[model samples]
Target: MQKAVGIIAEYNPFHKGHEYQIQQAKEQTGANIAIILMSGDFVQRGTPAIFAKHQRTAMALLGGADIVFELPSFYACGSAEYFSSGAVSVFNALNSIDFLCFGSESGEIDTCRFLGKLLADEPKLYKEKLRSFLKQGLSFPAARKSALAEYLKEKDIPFSEDFLDTPNNILGIEYCKSLAAQNSSIAPVTIKRIGSSYHETSLSSEYPSASAIRRELIAAWNTQKFLSDTLKNAQPPAVKDYLCALLENETFLIEDDFSLLLKYELMKNTPESLCAFSDMSPDLARRIYHHLNTFETFTQFAEQLKTKELTYTRICRALLHVLLNIPSDLPAISPAYVRLLGFKKESSSFLRILQKNSDIPIITKAADYKKLLPKEVHSLFEKDLFASNLYETVKCNKKSTAFTNDLQKPPIIL
Candidate 1:
């Protein structure tokens, strides 16, 4: 039987770093097939993907993934904990996977497992210390780190204080925690991230961060220099060609494109109403309500809302939930179904094994939800559909093209 490894990612624009990760995952795990669980139209950072999901899916397939599954919008635009839990749950539901591979700065699976186990266990001392830090007005991430450090100190556990600082390491820890919490059989694997840091904004290295790539792409688009050599070198050949085609067609989207929609969402809702959306606390909702008059653009408003306790990405995600109408009382964790976005034609037998092993429905056609999902599951799936339609509407309006329903589109098979 063919072995498979699962990867959870956004692949916002599918760069060379991502291609390398997929290649290394297969090589390290000795897996015959790689399955990707990717974010849809929206990414975790509360921004629309630069290119559409299907385009990214094609890039993933070309980059070496056997099959690609869409992580629903609710989790896609959620915090690291929710994002990891939802993704892990989906992979767990797919019983054929042998391993879950992720890229991390630490690249220490044992350390990640230790931290994950500590967090999942949540001992009394850790809880007390965490609460104390929170009461001192520290942000959740800060509080958790401080609490964990203090708890480890008292327990005499050897660890590094900087492990929680890097984005990839933090996410990797969350993945480990999720796997532990679910008591999953799938083994966790980590590959060290190469080249630029996650937040690096300069395109000077052979493998630039996605952030740097996005910045370069946006700058090039604004200046009408669509085919820069620096940008070309940062991506895989297929992704480079796809990006060029998208640029030529003027089909790419950016954070500012949804400003009008966000403004409308803010204008109509009171602070109380806004608090109903996921990640919208009472304080944040009130702040957003007061800041409505000064709102200029999505990025600008997120900047305006930034504070010591609330990060810019958190604010953007909260505002996105408001715009998308994601409820605060939605399920705590777990995805409803596995929505296939694309696949390589040669992976048919592997796909069959996955289908036979999966516990939840694998949705290939958007229109067959009624037959494939339960009532409550269909309700959750509807949010994914609405998000896709909303994204399509924005893209179409920007391009001056007719609106096409996302449900009518078929999964990409290459």
Candidate 2:
């Protein structure tokens, strides 16, 4: 038996369900160690996490994972495909990771494999039919599922949404798809999600959604008012202090640190130039640019400009692509390196394994990265710069004007 298991996650705020997943992954695999690939300050849904990376990493460590690694912003904040690919790459680097574990709507690996195969084997005509359906008014996801199901039906492949529309399942499919594509030896597995489908707002005593918890925290509502019976074993970190730091003046990150660049990109740049980043279609940009002045914030702006088929998250990702100039080709080639944000003592062994087996360089510290890598690594540092700058710009009380202060400054936590 291998010494470790791989868990790809974003502990935006740890809760009962996640705890269950970690324990189950361990139980199912009979592996002693869990290597978690986590998103940094930003997550795939393109939002600042309620808690910072260190805190989340700390929570995972406190809960049970033997090691934690950062999933760089380049991959962390992108679409499902990129997120899965990045996690898969990191886990693949760790020859110790015998299993890649995740939570899904349906835990059936065979069904996931079937859908994963069809998506991988997408025929030329299938794409054409999908595009035509998009023209007739189907959303990209809807068109994709429709086209995929038609292909599956023709091939007599059995599959179901079992969870596609919900957020986690969508990413789960991508995970399976990525694993299949990479031909990784690690096995794919899923733990069916427990309660309140992804984004469900009401907080239940037994199975509250992470979104609900976030909403309560954002509203400054007391956790005692919403803590569930099942969550007794969960024990997330203190929320008040964390949120205070987030809402406080000059704490960690600021509001501008996030979408400000995107806002400016939308207002100042042309649709042609903006099309280069992740999922930035020209038509979407045309709509976004016109609505720029009409709304104030990204959320408001997306609300004002979004078509029925395009979700707020989808449009925001496009806008982010415009801001970062994240070309699709760039992710395909350049994001070969995985940046280490923060980790605990056990990570030393995991790092040794990664270094020994990884085909790509594993960057452990920012200062070292700057000294060793070329200017392109700046893309990675630049986003951090943007985060600091945006945070400063939004939180006026912060005295320091430097956005790059923490860059090459914050070393991995031992």
Q: What's every prediction's RMSD, in angstroms? A: 1.1, 3.9
lDDT tens per residue, model 1, 171-223: 99999999999999999999999999999998899999999988888787688
Per-residue CA lDDT of candidate 2, range 1-414, in tens?
Answer: 346778888886766677778889989888777778888766777666656676676667766666777776667778888888878877776566788888887777777766676566667867777888888887788888777777667767665643466667777778888888888888888888886767877665455677766665544433334333333333444432333444343233322345565676666777776676677777787887676667577667767767877777787667655555566655564355666655567557666776788766667765566665667766665665555344344433344543444454453454
Residue 110 shift from truth in candidate 2, angstroms = 1.4
Candidate 2 residue pairs in backbone clash: 254-391, 256-390, 257-390
Q: Each candidate's TM vs. the true structure?
A: 0.98, 0.85
Clashes of each: 0, 3
* Deviation of model 1 at 205, angstroms: 0.7
Global lDDT of each model? 0.89, 0.67
Candidate 1 residue runs with Cα over 4 Å from true position = 331-333
Residue 130 miss distance in model 1 (angstroms): 0.6
lDDT, residue 384, model 1: 88
TM-score: model 1 vs. ground truth: 0.98
Best candidate (score: lDDT) = 1
